[model samples]
Target: MKAFLLVGFGGLAGSMCRYATSLLFTRAQSDFAWGTWIANVLGCLLIGLIYGLSEKFQWLTPEWRLFLTTGFCGGYTTFSAFAFENLKLLESGNYWTFSIYSVTSFAIGLLAVAAGVFLTKM
Candidate 1:
């Protein structure tokens, strides 16, 4: 489908850009993971903008939304997805659920990555 092609192109470009940015920051000796944080924040903002625009203007093709939000933003930062899911919980007025989701996602995600790294080293 045409939308798939757009998503593919966006994914390719977004991935290459992410790789380049990661290397650029690491090479520049930037302190901390400013690169990741920056990427996440920018991705979040752009996704927000995209979502806003989507709601504001339904005239745009669905392909554009898929390319930018699903492809570019998805490739750029999964943090947007994470944040949005949490927001869904908050929106339901489930503050306790939000806290549980927050702690569990962070803790389990970190642990899982560590476990993966440790296992793959074998």
Candidate 2:
């Protein structure tokens, strides 16, 4: 029960943050779903940091890990939105945008995670 509450609260906070990001990006008037991309990539980076810290310093308890990774990061990242956006781009004949967005998101997301982990080593 305690763990559940922690995860629930973390998810709530993460979801709120993600929504705020979307609102901020919406103001930019760009067709790209920058908010979702940023959120997912940032979430990946954050999870990497959290895991690295956990491994290096034993800082986070299991409960904290669950809250941060499974709850917060899970809520913060938007895989469904990413997939849907890609579908929209494909359907709309924006192959160039779709290809770039899809490739960059994956590549950069992996790099962000690696960077976060590397930062912890230093």
TM-score for all predictions?
0.79, 0.60
Backbone N/Cα/C clashes per model: 0, 0
For candidate 2, the C-alpha RMSD (Å) to the true structure equals 16.0
Cα lDDT tens digits for candidate 2, 1-122: 99899889888988998898777765466788888778777777777787778989999999998898777877787563466468679989999999999999999999999999999999
Winning model by lDDT = 2
Q: For this target, which candidate reaches the highest TM-score against the unseen true structure?
A: 1
Cα displacement (angstroms), candidate 2, residue 77, comes to 1.1
Task: List clashing residue pairs in candidate 1.
Answer: none
lDDT of 1 by residue, 1-120 (tens): 887888888888777777776776654555688778877777788887887888898755778888987788778777876886787789899999999999999999999999999999
TM-score of 2: 0.60
Model 1 scores a C-alpha lDDT of 0.80
